[model samples]
Target: MTTQHLQNRVDPWGQLRTVASRGTRMGNRGILHNDANQVVRPWKHKRWVTCMLEFKQIKRPKPFSRGNYSELFFLDEATAFAAGHRPCGDCQKARHLDFKEKWLAANVDAQLRSAISMDDVDKVLHAERCVPGGGKTTFAATLGELPKGTMFEFAEAAFLVSAAGYLPWSFDGYGPAKRIDGATAVTVLTPASIVRAFEQGFVALVHASAGLDDPAAVASAQKNPS
Candidate 1:
């Protein structure tokens, strides 16, 4: 047999689509599909950290993708589901858009059947995005930028909160709840830059009071420093 024969016998790993190391299995039934092979493909997922399914309608698809890089792949639907890749909007745009619209419709239907309020639906959406700042980044200069706060304090706060998985949301209560800006409401919240500011301030307060030989003065300074 020629080299071609050996190559033919081997599976084409080249055809495999690239994806992130981590992925969560979507429980939506539409994610499973069969084509007479008894195999099923999951509906949709992300190509990377950013892209998310936004506005959509069932009748037409407008998938969000990054063009050719967002190529769709699946030896079959089952394998595609197994590998956990979803239709890309920019590349595989149509299919993904269709999936979103259908998902929203089904979600609304299920909620109605259960007599859940639209508010409940909003909560579900909120939980899904895992927003720490009311789903609006004050830092957004572009579509995908991080959210910043009025004091730029929120931005610093978010950098740490995002690492910890605790979105503290903004305090504005009007525009958007920013995790960073919200935390700053303490008047002395932690930030990457100011993580030790309060602690150091306390120590300085203590030292100054010790010089003055007055514990009461130290405590006062610690509580309300000039």
Candidate 2:
């Protein structure tokens, strides 16, 4: 028997797919699926976030139930961040708070406020990642200038800047690393504000396939600081 999958897997560009892999993180944007278990809309609210796949060992038999928020999966936190999602304040409270603090510190001039709320971050992120009517928003930046863990589009494909190289991204996992040039300008898929947060020392968790755990890759990366 073949198991059918739902169209709920989100990519770095925030587009939904029916991939077999469930990914490391899950999140929602309110009730976007209909009673028929079909995604009828892109999003239902501005508060888009990414959370742990298993929170408090909670179990839900019907993930796409009509009234409940649609369950969305991302390959990893890096992918989620690139897709304009922040950590969930419920399932991933500590992560969310850390992200918020770093994000607020990095975007001080963006909001012009003494105290920043998650809603404020959501508003800024929504504007940076989404178009008014439709489509994902992107900005241009030098590939090497972007911090490690940032995702960018290069040669019509998505790649994560791992160490000193770029790892090709896919729903299943990342591919081999490719050398990166500091002078190469590219369109970054991640939101500008999130990139700023990453620059401010906010480290995002990536899959092991990113070669972050490999000692040789680390040494190579250290030797070639791109």
Model 1, C-alpha of 69: deviation from truth (Å)? 7.0
123-179, model 1: which lDDT tens digit per residue? 443333223422221222121122221112233432112322223322111122333
Q: Write the per-residue lDDT of candidate 2 for residues 1-226, one digit (tens) a residue.
A: 5767888888889888886777777788888888788888889999999877666778865668757789888778889988888999998789888898888888886556557678878999999998865489999998879998899999989999877378999987789987868799999999999999999999988876786552212222211100
Error of 2 at 145 (Å): 0.3
Show the colliding residue pairs in model 2.
none
Q: After superposition, how far is residue 15 of candidate 1 from its true place, in Å?
A: 14
RMSD of 2: 6.8
Give each prediction's root-mean-square deviation over alpha carbons.
Answer: 22.8, 6.8
Candidate lDDT values, in order? 0.24, 0.82
The parts of candidate 1 lying over 4 Å away from their true place are 1-73, 108-226
Lowest-scoring 10 consecutive residues by lDDT in candidate 1?
Answer: 4-13
TM-score of each: 0.20, 0.90
Worst 10 residues of 2 by lDDT: 217-226
